[model samples]
Target: MKKITVKITSILIALAMVFTFVPASVVATEDVTEQTEQQEQVEEVVTEEEVVTEEEVVTEEEVVTEEEVVTEEEVVTEEEATTEEESTETVVFDDINHWAKDQILKMHAKGVVLGDDQGKFNPNNNITRAEFTAMVNRVFGFVAQAELSFTDVQGDEWYAEDLAKAVAAGYIDGYPDGTMLPNNYITRQEAAKIVVEVFGFADMSAVEGNEFADFAYVGEWAQNYVAIAKEKSYVKGYEDGTFKPQSNIRRGETVQMLVNSTGEIITEAGTYTEDFATNVVVRSADVVLEDLTIEGDLYLAPGVGEGEVVLENVVVEGTTFVAANANLAGEFATVVVNAPVAVNIVEQASITNFVVNNKAAGANITAIAAMVFEPKAAVKVNGQDVVAGSKVTVSGGGETVVEPPSSQDPIVEEEHSVYEFSFELPTEIVAEEDVEVAVTFAATEVKDLGYENVRFAFAVATDVEDAEVTFTAVDSEGTEYTFTNEGAWGPAAGFAIPADYTAATDWTLNFSKAGTYTITFQLVTVDGEVLVEGTQEVVVLEEATIVEEHSVYEFSFELPTEIVAEEDVEVAVTFAATEVKDLGYENVRFVFAVATDVEDAEVTFTAVDSEGTEYTFTNEGAWGPAAGFAIPADYTAATDWTLNFSKAGTYTITFQLVTVDGEVLVEGTQEVVVLEEATEEVIEEETTEETTEEV
Candidate 1:
């Protein structure tokens, strides 16, 4: 083509030389200059010569087609604007940081786009037809509506279904020869057309302003779609003020455009109740919502800012995550139920399968009236049954309290038959005393399936060494159980029963030392399934026996339940000498010593007589005898003692009666404690002189 142009220009220059006599050579030079300039215009035309050559033969029609393509190409120039090579080596894509950063990352996180096997996004590489079609299918979850027979798309190919779906969705079509050419790079205009169809934006009017300088290059058939995309901010022109319509769309740009069309990018704080029926992305500011229902997961995204979400009567079918650094606040019923915190069914709310986990601590879940149905056995607060109408305070992670179940509440238990056991014991028993207990166990016949084996387990709790438990009609077969040595110690013990055996057994127990003792029993089957459980209590009393040489006086005392360190504890002893025969016994005194665990605490005691006399005693013993107060000869029942501890620990306050010979007659001790921090009154008393000396 260049040779032909050069020859034509030479002939024109010679003609000009012959026609003009004005220095023929100079005239020829001017004509040649003009002709050369004209030839430069033709040579400037640039087309993808490689594509034409790949098609091979050049017929008359092909030549004309090439000229037209060259003409169109001549108008476009390599972009002169220096594109900033936005760097993001930290992002999934090495070159994904410019206009496509937000959109690319957003879609990547949504699992909508994954880079190549090399983990390179290759943001500048043109996306293949298959790649673009797959992205469109993912965005809309479109399925193939009909079979596709594209010559280039095989049934077993990876992108066959995506191609079929694209065709079914009326977004793409095969060539005249039934070839999809899925591996072929898709153009910007082609992508715009598919995106418009998938997003249902075809009905939208074309945006008025053709802001792109090269907008005229866009095919007439794709102008409307591209215009809509530009208006919606889904597609943007280069900084050079041109939208390269015929340019191949890159993989990164394709995903970015797809995400932009979805409108999932939230930039402000507000409740979204658009009924997405799928996962909702939460970005941006704090949000508050009520009565909103989401059919899918709710994600609290990162990098958005500090977010506080409040949900009221909201329902999420999928998981709801209040990610770390984010705060979720709301009542149980309105919050995410079935999570760490169980839902609250307040007042007339129908009962559902309920569970109270660690999250239930400080959580409210009570009803104004009885439940319509009973909750499941798993309904518990820290592993304990959460009785209806009871408040739960979760402390120390697992500790919890369950108030007695209301009598008006319905019972929730399996309808399985099991043995029932009961025990009866005297409530009051002296220390170092023996006690007897009668137990009754019964199991009704379940029509059939008689039990083959039954067991009874018992445990004794006390600070005593010599203890015994014996079952009267003992039998291994028709077993009558017994324990002669120290009954099983620790928290519990187990016992067993035989098949078809039901009887009452007398359990004799004895304690050699003093302290409170409690006996509990669990009746279970051979398989270790608990049938019935019961507990019986025996308070082993500690009595002070006075020597016959001195007069005897019996008295009881009560002290402060709690005392703080550095605080004065007023302990008023209300006593009367029942037998005041010996004037020596009449003059009673008091003493105190630190308990073994807290013997290091420096405790002091001051006793005051009724007539206004005070006697102070220093803490001087390590769990030993410490001298205390001596009541006046005319001392009455009203005597007060003040105690102060320098450290926190348990202490024993002992009361002693002195005879005339100055011999200690009888003494009794009770336990007391000092807390870590000083109490309100203790702080005040430490700072002031006035003290409230009350019992």
Candidate 2:
């Protein structure tokens, strides 16, 4: 993003340079020089006063006196002539101290307004409609001329091109009778209407009450525009509290109104790093803007075709218009459609309010992620009201999800067969830890009622890269099923729930990093038709303490790194006797726990001592005989264990030393791989060899 500090003065300078006009001060200086030369000639005439006395004797006393009076009259007349000459040579307005003097001069320097051929700027004179149109056209750079058909505006008229441009720009229109009174003086209200239209300020025309004492006298057609102009400070009421809207507007007043409504027009492709005190028109694309505050409306003009405009850390205090087929990225206050163009709200971009006006009936707004609309935000299309949570396709992202306002819960339409659906997740959990989420589902009327494929589908989306989710459910026959997805939607097959089931609860989520996550679930049919769906959010907090630092004791263990599925493999886990005695407890127990990612997978550990005694335990709990395999605390030798896996997947085995009070003194985890069951051919070969040996 390019950074440029553009002051309001710099904008005026740029505008002046664009039009190649002489400054009003320079014009004033030339007028002063001419006046000074005239004064020197007057002085030279005064030096000739002695010659009058030298010629006194040529005539009688009365004649000499009459000549003297004539000479004095001539001197006064010459002075008057010099004053007139000075006025004619003055290129600036006579009202140098006028209230709108600065604006008028600036407008003149920008070539938006001009003085007469006699070098007189009649500041207080009424401005004609043609003149106002020309000023507005120049201010907005509206050069595209429309074909004129007005009876009074011929092609050869001085204001013909300007009227054509204003008409083309859709700001000014002729009378319905096909006549444009070009030379007629435009009223204040009429100029206000044109100013509003030229600046695309119609959205702000909604006013609360009459702000002017004479507002009732304002033309009905121009009332709203007058209100908007007053609200925007482009026009003001008199000190007497009346907006003389019916009175013809003066040329200086017109300049002030136009200047108030003017803004910077960005015509080139580059970054703009200046805070704009007024509106900004983006006429070019491939522009990056940053760290700037725009106090007025922003226009993504139609000239920016198919190009991308990026706004970073930019704040717009007024409505924004997307009139181009452009990609926008960054934050915006309010965005409205002006053209029927496809607007891509790329990643990281957000719009506070989005409006699709009648002129942009088919405007397309697409976003990379779900666009959440504020509750108070107005989103309308072709004058029809559209609520928040309207589905929008998520390109280059996950499933399309529309988050409703937080004040209301998402209402599942009654048309969906599975009416009761909810996702219960912990609002906050420690990161790098496993957490359980409860899922409930019930169908009012199940489609394909007896189908076994009818199940629940779930998806987990998070900023954390290593986040994972597991779905577990139990059937009517006590058969447990589990499914796990790495980062996205789980199990293309989904988790099958019994047809008679209601509110099945066991689901698990694990986060490897601290972040926010969204969990979405849907009751899907056999053919993947979503019956009902809901989404919930969870916040994962960073772990307060590391596991190792919190452990009371430290120990090491060993187990089989790999094993075959459905097979019993002999494995031994050894813990140092000295480390156990260090606990100084008369009685303690050995704890083993196992968990895996395989669907419906289970692990069992059977302890075998030197005396050939065997004890069995499942990977269900920790610390006691009822929870896990317990070993005698006095045992000073290593214990051997047999492990068996029901399915092929990655498994985690945890070894812990704990007291009878169930306090773990030490704990460690080791990863184990459960490979697929041995091939049937190997078993057949072994059987054939045994049969042959017996034969």
Candidate 3:
């Protein structure tokens, strides 16, 4: 009951948010555009009344009690579940735009909608002319075609009238041929025209002013409409200042854009005042990590900029620290780092200036302790590679500089480093005739792991044709055994699994006990970082194993009659299931609803001889069920044929009332069957054995 209530509430919230968020000048219908390479919006449409009325009673008769029961049982054994059908299928919504498919439909019976000619919407498919027309028709009741001026449009065409009406209703346009090009892929311009027209906006003269980069491509006729849309907050440009007017808007972006455009942006602007002589004050919640420049004045806003709003170029003069991160919210707020971060932040907690001394020393630092000078292992520690990124223990004098603990938050690669690998050689002065092993370290770094097995990450690349770069882990203490690419040494593609290494494995790859080990990644290189390139270091923190998702499926059935071949027999069947472990599919139905119509139904002749010997008239070959055979035909006609379920399982069955629309939905089932009892010996064995097994 709680679950159902929550589901209903979530749907209501979504619907309300959508309405409040839509812009002032625009009204949007529930849109489900079919795009080949993009996902559609996840819409939850709840009635307005339902959103307001919390006290409304949900009748018990309408509740799916079986789901409640199944939900309880699903708490166990879900891992063993598997999909039985070879073909992939999903449920279809009653409307053309559906997230899931359903059988034994009711929405269609209410005259609210209709399925495609095949009686299936092909929910996962792209939309076609006929289908889109049908969908549009369902949304807007069929109307007499308003006379169209296009010569290509004809009354004889099935969709001709619909295309004409859609245009007449200001939904689309047609060429001079009178033919509305319904089959062409909808373009951005065409889409824009429809949107403006639908929103009841009249075409206007082009904006006779300087156009920003965002509106550079807007058509002359559509310029005024675009301007109005912008002023009314109906659209936004990308951060790069390009509106991408001609590009097809993605489904996710479309939703977000719609939300931003329509919602009221109320902001309570205030100033944050702080002393910048000692510290740096960031008024905006999000601060960039990149270097920043503020006018030679330092002052915090008297108070903070209050409210959920996209903060843009807020002015901050005086001393300032530019955020290093390329992307940060609230990029502009006048402030400064009057002093270096290290000195100021430590002593004065309230100081707004960042002095240069706050950096961690000794074992705390990582980039320095682990260094790969070559461009291959281009590891950047804050700013400096060798000195800055190195690990350190104490600061004032010389302290123990070793690896720290494992990295809790691992360093994620923004992009995959591309490289060419081969055993080819350049002839400056080679050791091996074919190749020379010149160690070039890719970018490297160590992670913060609170003293766990401290590990570092590195990358390697080469131009050798069947080339696999190997890392030879050597002791940082001595120069005797060195890095090599000979044996198993490279990590997995994701750099998750380490390759098996033999020489110096103890010092380099082995983590026999949780202690700090300095790992240096080296690769044989030829010259200035061209053949190979990548980040070099990362710290491994912990090992975790987890299982993802689980669910349950159960189904059962039995034949209707034993010997009623002379008359039509209504096959009795039911759905009953419970979930265990929930590792797989829930809400699974038995595929046993195949009705035996006159064409597919059959009656055959067969009898047993009265004597000890038996003779058969019509052989049972090719007799029962389609797709593989079942329930031998030689048995008495209609002798309650044993039905095969989509899957095998022991499910508790309970019938439910079903409805076409609102009438008494299907009444609960009366007849039920439990799996037959096992043999006494079998039961005894199961009880005695270490592991009980069932078939």
The residue-by-residue lDDT of candidate 2 on 1-695, one tens digit each, is 11112222111110010000000000000011111111122212222332333223322222211111112111112212233234333448653333344455555655567766556556555666777677665554544566665546557866777777766666655664446777766677777777676667765645668577887887777778777777876665554567767766666566656555655556567777767777766766687778788888887765565676777767787888777766666667788776667666666666677665545645656656345432222343223344443433343442344444345565333232345667666656887677887777666566444333345567778777866656555655666766665221223334555445576576666666687878778666423356567788878788754332221344455555447888898776666544333233335666778877778888888875566666787775443344444333333445666788898888888887776678876677878877786567767977999999999
lDDT of 2 at 432: 64
Per-model clash counts, in order, read: 16, 0, 120
For model 2, what is the C-alpha lDDT against the true structure? 0.57
All candidates' TM-scores? 0.28, 0.39, 0.21
Model 1, 1-695: lDDT tens digits are: 11011112121110000000000000000000001122222322334551233224333333321111112111211121111122122357554533344446655554566666555565445566776666655554443344554545556776766666666555665654445677666677777766665444566797587656887887887788778767655566554566677766665556556554553433346665444444454555466545666664454433233444445555656445332123332222212222222232333222222333222233333333232322222344334555444544433323445555466774433244456667777755554455667788666543323343344556767656654433333443665445643232111222333434477776666555566667677764422355667776666657645534434555466777678888888877655555555443343344344453665567787775545666676763221124434543334565666878887877776665544445666565777777899678756865675444431
Distance (Å) between predicted and true CA of 503, model 2? 73
- Clashes counted in candidate 2 amount to 0
TM-score of 1: 0.28
Ranking by lDDT: 2, 1, 3
State candidate 2's TM-score: 0.39
Best TM-score among the predictions, by candidate number: 2
- What are the Cα lDDT values of the candidates? 0.49, 0.57, 0.30
